[model samples]
Target: MQFTSEVIIATYNKPDYLRLCLKSIAEQSQRPTSICLADDGSDARIDPVIEAFREAHPDLPLRRSWHEDQGFRKSVALNRAIAGSTCDYLVFLDDDVILHPEALARHFSCATRGRYLTGSLIRLDADLTGRLLEAQSYGWAEGRLAGWTPKGRSQWLKSMPFPSGVMALFDRLSPVAPNFQGACASVWRDDVLRVNGFEGNMSYGGLDKEIGVRLRNAGIRGRHVRYTAPAYHLDHGRSYADQKVKSANRAYILALRKSGETRAVNGIAELDAV
Candidate 1:
């Protein structure tokens, strides 16, 4: 069945990364119904890139929401996008990841009722990321690796594509926990509304997984498409990443896990009122 899907990208002042990310979206085998960019207080430069992209793809529906230059409020940015998105399905992506041609196709193929689909990203080295930023769309397919390109746990595994039959078998037999990764995840819009959307109080770490915890509590199982829906994560220094905030967020998520919380206090519904 063909579901109307919207791609929500969280971006903050990274124009180059956003440019590459937008290019990949334009090249997707299956175009998303719309593109919603949740801009977390980006500068004037980012607007030109957005305008250029809009001019380049006049047919693609693109909308962006922006707030003032506050601290890291990525969850808020995402929630605002959630409030505005009108679609049957929503795909979340960080502006730093470049996707393969089949990434959206793989994601949509895995869409099922009562479940949100999660996929993985192959982290690129600084050198490779630079190379990717310099390369054109025709040259970007190399990011999908045959083996672990950067040598991290399951990076190579996630980057590799498998036959549909083989992947279905492995996904069913796997004993590992299925986690929601924000960089590459898709869900029914109504299911997201059921959970009240992403935790707006979160900072950086485990923000996406926190939503997964709530979704599970709300009885929405996760479908893992890590192997089939591969995207390349561009490596960059996290100026916004705070270990303290991350630890706090992680602890909060664990507490939510114990409490079996199913809805976010400061999420889409709440933000919509403000």
Candidate 2:
């Protein structure tokens, strides 16, 4: 099935990056039915940036919403955005990232049942060193990775880089595998709602990993879109990136472990909020 819409859920305090992010979407080979950006309440300047994009792309369906800048609970804001969209598939991305013209098309092609698709994020150290891209420019595009790339070299151009076969093998063996990452992922709306949408309680990080585990527990298998669909990550020094290693975020994983509930791939729960 070809979905006419793709939702790119993003949140950031930086206005400049948000502007470029919107522009990149406008350039997609297959334009989204609607581009919705959920801002986790940012500085006053952020509003104008969003407004400017909206004005320039008046013909393109775009929606924007915000929550008061309270604690940096990305999960809650993400849920808010997801609940607001009616797209057949949702694509979550970071604010500073840029997509290749065919990024959306590649993800659409990789859609498969019981498979939660994952894509690599190419990071360029120099471009992101100063927070936002120096000139709203994308670095380079990487098809895939043999292993996880650090924050710096995620976007370096590479031809046919392989993925970590060990990681793939381990995922196939483990009951719960790591498959979810925001850089580039495509999931059905029903599958996402089945897990209650990102565990709004997770304060800073680990929400994506925990959700992937929950999906696995729910019987959905992991799928990697490596070498097929690639994206570029503009480097920024956000604390959330480093928070993956923080012990506090690990608590979110423990919460999932305690649930003992598995989501079956063949079914979906009706979300009243959705």
Candidate 3:
């Protein structure tokens, strides 16, 4: 069965970043059925920003909604957007990232018989240069390979083999994989709803980790699109970095593991529960 997914771009106060993100989405080789802008209660600035874009691209399938400031619980904002939409698949992205030209087409093309499909991100500096390349150029981190493309750069990727012991260790560490960024991923609409959207408690950190865990618990296999359909993350000040915030994220993960509650977040049910 073939289906088209609506790309959801979640934004907050960063109007400049929002414009860039939307521009990238606008130039996609295969445009999404619609672009849903889910704002996490921002100041009046966002309205003008969105309106400007809307005026520029009158035919663009752009939708907008805003909610009150909900602390660090971005999951709540995401769920709110999901509940407000009607699409076969959901493509999730952060506001500070730019998609490759074929991002949406590749994601939907490969989303078969799985609950989730995750792509890798190339972490670029604020200036949009390759960090690894910079390290090699400055003779900081010695490199064995001349030009190694990190996972999720494009559709073509090379395979490398490691020892069985190392592979076993890697499998054990699946729950805490370092590259579990949900910014460049997609999920079946039904599968996401079945899992009850995201855990409302995990607002700031660990929200991505917790949602990934739940998907795994529900027997949803994750397909990594490393070196394929890569998105670029625009680096900025890590405002979400705080000791207290990380602790709260860790506690939430522990609770998710202990409770073992796995269910879909249906839109109607979400409204009724709230």
Q: Which candidate is the best by TM-score?
A: 1
Give the alpha carbon lDDT tens digit for every residue of 136-217 in model 1: 3325335453222557646655665456567666666657778889998999999999999998888889999999999999
Q: Lowest summed-lDDT stretch of 10 residues in model 2? A: 264-273
For model 3, the stretches where C-alpha displacement exceeds 4 angstroms are 128-180, 254-259, 264-274
Better of 1 and 3 by lDDT: 1
Q: Roughly what TM-score does model 3 have, to 2 decimal places? A: 0.76
Q: Which candidate, 2 or 3, has the higher TM-score?
A: 2
**Lowest-sum lDDT 10-residue window in model 3:** 136-145
Q: What order do you get sorting by TM-score, best first?
A: 1, 2, 3
* Model 2 C-alpha RMSD to native: 5.9
**Pairs with steric clashes in candidate 2:** 122-154, 122-155, 123-154, 123-155, 146-164, 217-262, 218-262, 218-263
Q: What is the lDDT, from 0 to 100, of the residue 22 in candidate 1?
A: 92
- Give the best candidate by lDDT: 1
Q: After superposition, how far is residue 94 of candidate 1 from its true place, in Å?
A: 0.2
Each prediction's TM-score against the native?
0.92, 0.77, 0.76
Model 1 TM-score is 0.92
lDDT over C-alpha atoms for residue 271 of model 3: 51
Which of 2 and 3 is the better model by lDDT? 3
**Which residue runs of candidate 2 sit more than 4 Å off their true CA positions?**
127-132, 138-178, 239-245, 254-259, 262-274
